[model samples]
Each structure stands twice: as structure tokens, then as C-alpha cells.
Target: MARKVGIYTRISRDDEGESLGVARQREDCERLADLRNWQAVKVYEDNDVSAFKRNVRREEFELMLTDLRAGLIDGIVAYDLDRLARKPQDLERLIEIYDDRPRLEFATVTNDVNLGTADGRTMARVMVAFANKSSHDTSRRLKRKHLELAQQGKASGGPAPYGWQKGDPEKVDQEAARHIKEAQKELLAGVRIGTIRTRWQEQGLGNPREGTKRMAHHRVTHILTNPRLVGYRTYHGEILYGEDGSPVMGDWETINTVEEWEAVCAVVAERQKSQPGRSLARTYLLSGIARCGLCKSKIRGQTNHKWQPGSKGARYKYQCSKVNGGCGKVARVGEPVDELIAQLALEEQRDRAASADVSPERRWPREQELNDLNTDIAQLIEAEKNKSISVSTLLQVLPEKERQRDELKLDRARFYKEQKQAEAKDDAVDLSLEEFFDLPIERQREIVLHSLSAVFIHPSGRGKRVFDPDLIEPVWRE
Candidate 1:
């Protein structure tokens, strides 16, 4: 009787995401079975899956073993011995199956093997070992190549990051770059990552890695913290450095200068260390911005439920609570306070827009210091290139200089961010002060905090009959 055979085929990778490798393997295995006049009863395929990789389970290979144990096939045919396994341990497993069913057949098109005998199993083990060595050598070569590319400040091939175009890593997506720059400024100005993510999604920006039009908070953090933002090439999340202790700047156009990137990174690191986890979204328009004029404590939104029958009397108001280090004497109806503050904030924005200064005045003394540091760094690098400064000496001297420059830049970044917040000439919320109610409370709260230092809710006379706008005093920021 002709032996029933299971044809097994596999490929370590499908470069084009197609199973072309396994298709050729299957054709070869079928021809071998035909030559042997064996009935090809089954085809087990583990396409685009690695067999040599440690802990990578080949599902079809395991199923074929199960089938062999159940006496479904008397023989196994593969295109090559290495296609079945690249590890000697894996070969030993198949040998054990052969030892159990001593009459069961195993053969490959590339190599004639008699699995019935111990010598054939030993030969298979040797071939598997050689295949394993080949895979290890290939992996090492690829890793070395990638390290070389990173050292030269080249992208090692993948989808481009958020602010760059795919395939053309050097080209910047202007719109995305603008969004990223705005986000960096916003974050440095004390806006939460969640807030930035909300605005990005609202503006139809997507996380390309996730292949969706929805932005994620973590993705925002990743973009902000990435070395690519400042034009440094990276491999495995680490910035590549040259022998002279200088970073390997990439070919891509950087969104932020090295100083700006370092400043933003430092701020984000401090925030992470202090907070350690996600913060709850702000639900009130002026929770932290409004203060009690009585005790000068921040006010919070409060809801009072009236549990009376057939009465719709749930009142939402802003109040000062003793629990939050506030005097318990202050209370105000929320609607008018929100409206009055919103109108005042609007007028502040319009006034800033109509001011004579188009851009905020920068401190040139500090700016000159930063520029001097850059000149020093450039001269140091030139000395290294000319071999006047040794790599060891450059390494020792450059970092301290860079650190001092970074500290100055961090302070500078803070100054600019605060100035921008104080002079918010652009309509960020895209709504008039009267239309503040239409915006999210988070957005409205952001505008309020940026536009004013504190909104003081003073004590009104007892038995108040009407809301008074004069009772709410807004202390505007200079």
C-alpha cells in the first residue's frame, strides 16, 4: 500500500506580506511525494512564521505531530530538513516521534533521509544545527548593519514618525510639525497630555503607528519625548552618539532645536516623576482658577441635589469648602460667574491681539549666552575633527558645557511659554466669550487659567435675590 504523507512547508518571513516562499515549498514537496508515489493526504503550512526563533511555536507543525500520533499519516514530506526545524532540540522531538512509530516515514525533497534508523536522525540533527548557526549569523549581521546606520544618523527603515512623511524621512509634514510644535509649547505651559490629545483628535490628527484617526495620550508623550524631534538618530530608544560625545544628528528636518527638545524633555520628566500616573480630566470650568475672596482659597464646582418629590431642583454652583483648605463661607451660582469670567477673558484676548507688539519681547542677554554656547560647541567639534582635541578630552569637556547650556534653555523655554500664555493673542478655543458654554469645560478651564491668575468669588449680602457680576473679581496676569 502507498504511504499517506503530510506535506509541511514554512518560511521565516514574508517580506511583502505574501506567502510566496511557502507556495514554492509546497509545490516542491508535492512533486517529491508524487515521485515517491505516496498519497499527499494533508498539507500543513506555517507561512511567514519562523521555526528557528526561540519560543516561536509553529501551530501547523504541532498539529501535524498530533495527526501523526493519531495514525492519520504514515509519512511526512517537506521541501527541506531546515524547513521542518533549525534547532537540534526540535529535531530530537521529531526523532522521538519516529522512535515511537518506528515504521513511520519522514523525507525531504532536498535531502534523502530515512527517519526509521538512528543514523538518519543524527544526520538531521547535524543539518538543523547548521541551519541554526546560519540564522544566528544573519541576525548578528543585521544588528551590526542597523548599528552602523544609527551611528551615521540614518533611519533604519520603517514608517516615518509623526512629523515626517513616510518613505521620505527628511521631508517634514508642515501641518503635523505645526501641531507638534504647538503641543510642545502647550505642555511646557502646564497643559496636560490628555488635553493635548483631545485637541489633536478634535483637529483630525491620527497616530500613524496605530493606523487610526484617533490620537492617544501615550502617542503624544512618545512624540514629545522622541529624539527625532530634535534631529538626532536613535536605535532601540537610545540616541546614537559619536566618539566626540556629540549626538548623531539625522538627515531629517528637526521640529525642535536641541535646546528646545531638551527643555521640553526635562519638564516632561519632572511632571512624570511628580505625578507618576494619569490625572483625572478637569470637569469644572474654573475649579483651580477661581478663588474664594474670603479666605483666598481656590474654588471648586459643587452640585446640590434636592430630594423633594416632583421637584427639579438640582443646583450646580461654585463653592469654597473647608475640606480643601478653603473658608466654607463663600458660594455663588455657577452660570453667571462662568458667563462673566468668560466675557472678561474674551476681552483680554481681543486686547492682546490689538496690542502693538506682534511677538513677545525676548531676553537677548540669555539668548546671546545660548548662541555663545553653540559657538563654543561648534569650535570644540571642529577641534575634534582636526584632531587637535582628543576624543577622550572632547568627551570630558563637551558634556559639562552642554549641561550648562541645557539648564539655560530650560529656563528660557519656561519664559517663552509663560509669555505666550499671558499674551494669548490667537483664538485657541475658536469660540467667542459668550460661546464659552459651547466648548468643553476642560477647554474653557484652560482659557480661564491662561487668561487670569485668579477669579475671586467674594461674599454677597445674605438672602441674595439676584446674581451680581461685580462680586466676582478677576485678577488678570501681567
Candidate 2:
């Protein structure tokens, strides 16, 4: 019986208009198999794949390995030893597979090794080491080339970020740019990152990493945090600092000012510190916001089916957490208090909407000031680079300007977010909120927390009495 054989061919990159390299490999492998009188049972081709890249998945190569292990093939053939693997560990794995099946034969167009002999195994390992060395040399050369590009202020290769184009960050993809800005506004308006991700997924936004329509919250957060959005170059998750120790500007239209970017970063960092585990997955609307006016302790939510001795149904209340431990101050019901807070917030929102109109004159001059500040920083950096000023002088000149810019940016984010919320259609009653009664819990929670700094519940003197709204004192956030 003829020896059953599997032919494998791979090309690191596809040539423009054709894949002639893999075709040549296939031809060479087939000719070798024919010379040995082996029956070619399968031909596996992995195109546009790199054997040297450990993370890259080569589907056909994996399938061929599986078939070889399952006894479906008696031998393996490739164009060369390097075509089979470029990593030492991968070569070791192949050798182990061969050792498990002593009858298995390995052949290449340029060389053949006897897997059954110790000396032959040593020779194969030496050949694999050479291939591995070549792969490392190529990687080093590529890294050097990338460093040259960076020194020349050029884009390092790969897909550009969502709103920008590859090799030309100056041109913005308008659709993507709009989405990016809208997401920022939504984030500022108290919408959760997870909620923003779901909305973007439904809008058919594709993630650059996975090329999928749906994205994770961390991905959303990354887009929000990227310094590249403000026209700075970044490498390995950090904004590139020049020899003068200043941020290197990219050749792109800035979506935001550096101050705005830093302000957003500050807000996110502060939130993470204050509420270590507080997430958009919060269960209650008024969990920590409601307080007991009498004891100055938190008012917590609870449900009881027998609160007044005759009530047959469960009742939800925002009561003092220490009701059994000496504090009698409590709100007998949750709904009425929630309604009162919501109504107060709604009135304020309407008033603000009616009064505020941000004209171009009011908005443009501040933006111009931010641009000038960035220019001044750049000039100081350039001066330092030219040895005209000391590093200490540059640092002393820029901190005050940078601080002003950050404050302006934060103010702009807050005002813009408020304007967006005022203009957006309020639909808190849909299942989009997921929890609470008669409204979306997130919207209600945002309104409650934003409008009233504190909702203090005072006890109404011990006896059997009706739940009164007068006993609740609301403190305004402003």
C-alpha cells in the first residue's frame, strides 16, 4: 500500500492580484510527494498567514495537525522546513507528535529527516533553530523600520482608529466622528458605558479589533480615553513624549483640545477612586443618596408585606437603615418620594432648556483660547528642543495655561451634555431602564441624584399615620 501523505502550503502575505507563492509551494510539495510514490490524501493551504506570529491563527495548519494525529495521514510534506514552522516550541510539538506515532514520516522539498533516529531529531532541531533565528532577525528589522517612521512623524502600520483614516489621520470619517462625539456626550449625561455600547451595537458600529458590530464596555472606555482623539500620537497605550518631554502632535484634525482630553481623564479617574465598585449595574435608584434627617444616617430601601399590621400586599419604602437600632426616622413608601424628586428635576430641566442658548460668539472664543494655549505649549517644547530654554522654564510656563484649558474643557463637556439631554426625547418608561416601576431606573436615578443632593426622611411621631410628603426634606445639588 502507498504511504498516505498530507501536503501543506503557506504564504505569510498575499501578493497583490495573485497568490503565486503558495501555488509554487504546492507545486514543489506535490512534485516531492510524486517522486516518493506517496498517495497525497489531503492538501492544506493557509494563505496570508505568518508562521512566525504566535498569536495569528492558521486554521488549515491546525486542521492538518489534527488529521495527522488521528491516523488519517501517515506522512507530512511541505516546500521547506521553515514552511512547516518558524518557532522552536512549534517544532518541538511536531517532534512530539512524530514520536507518538513512530511510523509517521516527515519530508520537505529541500530536505528529509528521519524522526525515528536521535541524530536525525537533533539535525531537525538545528534546522528549526536556524529558521527561528531568521524569524527573530526579520522582527528586529521591522521594529527598526517602525522606529524610523515614528522619528519621521509618520503613522506606524495597522488599521487607523475609528474616526481617522490610515496613513492620513488628517481626514476624518464623518459618520464615525459623529458617533465618537455623541458617545462622549452620552457618557457625560450619566448613561453607563455598557448602555452606550449596546446602543452603538444596535446602530451597527463595528469594533476595530474584532471587526464585530457589538463591543465591550472596556472597548468603549478605551475610545473615550484615547489621546489620539485630540490629535496626539500614541504608542503602546501612552501618548508619545518628545525628547523635550512634551506630547508629540499627530497630523490630524483634533476632535478635542488637550485640556478637554485631560479633564475627561480626571473625571474618570476620580469616579474610579470614589466608587471603587460602583457600576452602571447599580440595583437601586436611591441606594446611597437618601438619608435619615433625624440621625444623619443613610435611608435604605426595603419591602414588607405586613408593615401596618393589616396590609395584605408587599410595600416598598425608603426607610432608615438603623430602624431597629434606635433610629425611628423613615419614609413609609418609595413611590411618592421618587415621584416628588422626579417632578422637581423635570421642572428644573425645563427651566434650563427654556433659558439657555449657547451662541457661536459664546462658544468659539473659548475654543480659540484653548487652541492658542496648545500652540504656546508646542512653541515652549520646540524652544526646549532647540536649547533656548531649560526644562524647568518650560514646565513653569505651561502648568497654569494647562490648568485653565482643562477647566474650560470640563465646563464645555458639562454644558454640552446638559444641552443634549434637554434636546433629547425623554423615554424613561420603556424596558430600556430594565428595573423600577413606571420609569427607567437609570433616568430616574440620574435626575434624583443630580437635582437633589440629598433626600432626607424625618420620622412622623410614632403612631399609625399616613405617609406624608411634607416629612421629606429635599436638598438641591446646586
* Candidate achieving the largest TM-score: 1
What C-alpha lDDT, on a 0 to 100 scale, does residue 190 get in candidate 2? 61
Candidate 1: worst 10 consecutive residues by lDDT?
421-430
Look at candidate 1 and give me any clashing residue pairs: none
Where in model 1 is the C-alpha error above 4 Å?
Answer: 1-128, 198-205, 208-217, 243-246, 256-263, 278-280, 292-297, 303-316, 322-333, 352-356, 359-431, 434-443, 458-466
The digit string of per-residue lDDT tens for model 1 on 137-201 reads: 99899899999889988877755777987558789888888888877776665668887787777
Leading candidate by lDDT: 1
For model 2, residues 274-370, the per-residue Cα lDDT tens digits are 8777775555567677788788787767776466656644367777765445275455577667666666666666565568674542243376776
Clashing pairs counted in every model: 0, 0
Q: Say what the RMSD of model 2 is.
A: 7.4
Q: How does residue 85 of candidate 2 score in lDDT? A: 83
TM-score of each: 0.66, 0.64
